[model samples]
Target: MKIYADNAATTKMSPAAVQVMIRCMEEDYGNPSSLYTIGQKAKETLELAREDVAAVINASPREIYFTSGGSEADNQALLTAAQIGKKKGKMHIISSAFEHHAILHTLQRLEKDGFEVTLLDVHEDGLVRPEELEAAIREDTCLVTIMYANNEIGTIQPIAEIGAICRAHQVLFHTDAVQAVGHLPIDVEAENIDMLSASGHKFHGPKGAGFLYVKKGIPVTNLIEGGAQERGKRAGTENVPAIAAMTEALKEAVANLEANTKRQLEIRNRLIEGILEIPHTALNGDAVKRLPGNANFCFEGIEGESLLLLLDDKGISASSGSACTSGSLDPSHVLLAIGRVHDVAHGSLRLSMDAATTDEEVEYLIQSVKEVVEYLRGFSPIWRDLMNGKKEFIL
Candidate 1:
């Protein structure tokens, strides 16, 4: 069937984005930093793209800073907040335990440099508690960075509530909204977000394109130093073509968000229902609070790696967890954080649908998964032991 179900990893660029990219590359091929007529046209395209991207999140064009992608944006956001906090004598940061590696690894580096980080527990539902986050803030806490939506388990955090609490406490709030930006509606001002990060490829835009949103008066510093591009905060020849394509993609996504959400939700819920019909299977996150196209499950008595390989052989593309960490041999940290033990966590499957996914495709996926799990379990010694009651079933 050649089903590609891993939309959380990335998506195919839309035709509108491709056309905009081609137009920019072919006709508007001038440096936005140059001071000539051609360059002026390119610069105009860049600024208009900035405005379009800003409008998607209800942000001002001046507040948006282009970047290579989500990782750079995340690093810059953290660096900016940490530097600002350092000057103000605050060195503590708060985040959730299940955040993407971009945020988690940066927090680790910051910890080495004398910043205290508190990663609140995401309970079995994979949702952070707003009260706990509010209680974690202190006089020394300067930033509370949480992801708007999880990349693996697909849990959508209570960003509005968390942002309100951070604002009440006079702390800066940042969210890595890489997975939520185009899929979900975001209003940075209304959400009280002080800083935000987004990537392009997550929503049918080309990769290597993204932007960081910093509320005015937050003083952004250069993550790279050179020319005075990106308001002197990001120094490089601006990628005008990528930026324009990304902006077009964002605008299209926002325009069709309601209809796409409705369609994907139906497929996602059906996938969940069909998959859970298997014995000893369980969903990983809050069903209703997750992204419309995401469904993660842990099937007892099978290995995730083998499941993926077999599914691939069946012409279906899927993942056990985050694509960024797919090479690792260890089980997913996000699944573990949600209280899944190692055995169950190792048997996980993540099927992320998209607007193109159809009900027939989802039905094929359900049947294929059922057959694969049953076949894998037939020869697994672990399954044998569980069936014989030598080892207890977790899921």
Candidate 2:
């Protein structure tokens, strides 16, 4: 049952995205920088893609700037906002503790450069409280950057509320919406967003393709400095083919967003319910507020690496947490932020199913996970310790 349950890592590109990419590669291969006809054609394609992406988020086409992916977009947004705030004598920034490393590491760098950053606590439910965020804001708060949805636990943040708070305080708000872009309905204007970062691969588009939404009038700092492409903000030749592919993918995903969310929710809940039936297993994040396709859990015994390997043997691909940090022996920081102990955090599994996931596949996943966990626990000394009352059970 070779079920690919790790959509959070990256999704298989949709047929439409692939077709568009191929067509662009073959027919629109010219550099958008040239003044020739072929180059102009490629340029048109690029603008069209930008327009489509902007439309999906209720943003102006002029406000969208293409980038390598979410990480670059995040860097651009944070730095640009910081620059803007610095001119106004604001140096403090606010964000949540559980933000993606792209945002967190950038914050760390800014900290070294004399910026004070306050990371609000995301409660055990993995949701950041807007009031807490508001309270953390200071007169010098330049930016309030938070993720629209968590990458590991999949808890959807209250972006609109957070944005409103930032707007009321006249601070720039940035959201890393890489995981929430096409999967969730987004209206940047209605949500009071000043900047947004999204990656294409998260929504079944080609990797290395994404865009940053900087509200009109906000200057974007160049992450890549070279040619005058991307309005002279992003240097180098534009990736026309990948950009076209991502646009089509984003459109397709948004066109069916409601139906996809509903279907995925049903499948995800079923999977979660079945997994919870296993003793000493607990679901991470708020059950109702999480993404439709994300179901994360921590078992009391056994390591997540062993569980992932065994699940792979069963043809069920999953993860312990973010794919970026999968190679690390350290447990997921997300789980730790949510108050999961080291032992429990090490036993985590994250199953992210896409809209196309099937019930039969989910059933196989349930059975396979149950078998693997039970099998690992059977031989685990930690399980024996918990059973014999030598170690206390946390979950």
Candidate 3:
């Protein structure tokens, strides 16, 4: 049986979402920018979508700006914040080392352009301490950007506490909630977040559709310059169909968030418990503070790539790190930032489930992982030496 456990990277588009998208593509194919009757219908659909997305985060419809995806939204947040706050002599931006590259690389580019960046370190459990974040804020710090939950390790940061600190410092706060939106509850108002980013695909919606929430009155420069679209904040013709489908998907995902969270927590715990029962295996993130659907761990004396290939052969899909950076040979920066040594980092695996995941599937994965780890460890000289209590073998 095929088991898909990589929901953190992206989920299969829900049937409901697909149906809505198809209807829009076939019947409602009109430019929202046009003033014709069909265009008016499309524009209405788009407006309703905005309301749905806004409802999920408890933000007003006008505060949300649709973007191509999470990357663009993140870029818009950082660049806009930095640009608007430049004249205030507060060019420094603070973020954790475990942020998605969307935030990390953008901050790196800003640094190259003479902006100061403070990359706060994460604890061994892959969590950034709120106190550490508060300490990192400075007079020249324009914005504080952090992820709601890590994509690889599944560690949920203390975003509410961090946001409160930023509020007290009077600094703009942004969070890349790409992984946290549908998986967990988020209230921009309660968290005091000035800006937030999320991707549709992350929550079973179509790809290439996302939104950025910018609190009203926060001045941000437009990332794209063109004819007035997205109220002149984002450029190009709005993708009405994808936006509508995304709204439906978001509503469905969040409607039963409590039930889904409970189910995922049960499945995730079973998977983690099963994996920990295996020898020489260790969990990679905080047990209590993580996404309910995420389970990341490392198997000593085995390579993550090898394990992934084995699992794939068994019809199980998984990942070693962020799907965006999985092709690179270098280890994940997020893993390294959490103080994992190269060897442990190299052996890491991330297994994230979703609302559709089943108990049988989890059991199958647990069994498959056990067999693969045993098979791999049998060939490892380190395992053999340790088993024999012989540690003096010279290379």
Per-residue lDDT for 283-363 in model 1, tens only?
Answer: 999999999999999999999999999999999999999999997989999998989999999999999999888778999
- The clash count for each model shown is 0, 0, 0
**Which pairs clash (backbone N, Cα, C closer than 3 Å) in model 1?**
none
What is the TM-score of each predicted model, taking all chains together? Answer: 0.99, 0.99, 0.97
lDDT of 3 by residue, 1-395 (tens): 99999999999998999999999999789999889989988999999899989999999999999999899999999998999778788889999888999999999999998899999999988898899888888888999999999999889999899989999999999999999998899999999999999999999999999999999998767989998988888889999889988888899999879999999999999999999998778888899899999999887777888899999999999999999988787888888898877766777889999867888888999999999989988898766776787753211
Model 2: pairs clashing at backbone N, Cα or C within 3 Å: none
Which segments of model 3 are wrong by more than 4 Å? 381-395
Cα displacement (Å) at residue 124, model 2: 0.8
Give the backbone clash total of model 1: 0
Better by lDDT, candidate 3 or 1: 1
Q: Which parts of model 1 have CA positions greater than 4 angstroms off?
A: none
Kindly provide the TM-score of model 3 when superposed on the true structure, using C-alpha atoms: 0.97
Q: Rate the local accuracy (lDDT) of all candidates.
A: 0.94, 0.94, 0.90
Cα-based lDDT at residue 76, candidate 1: 91
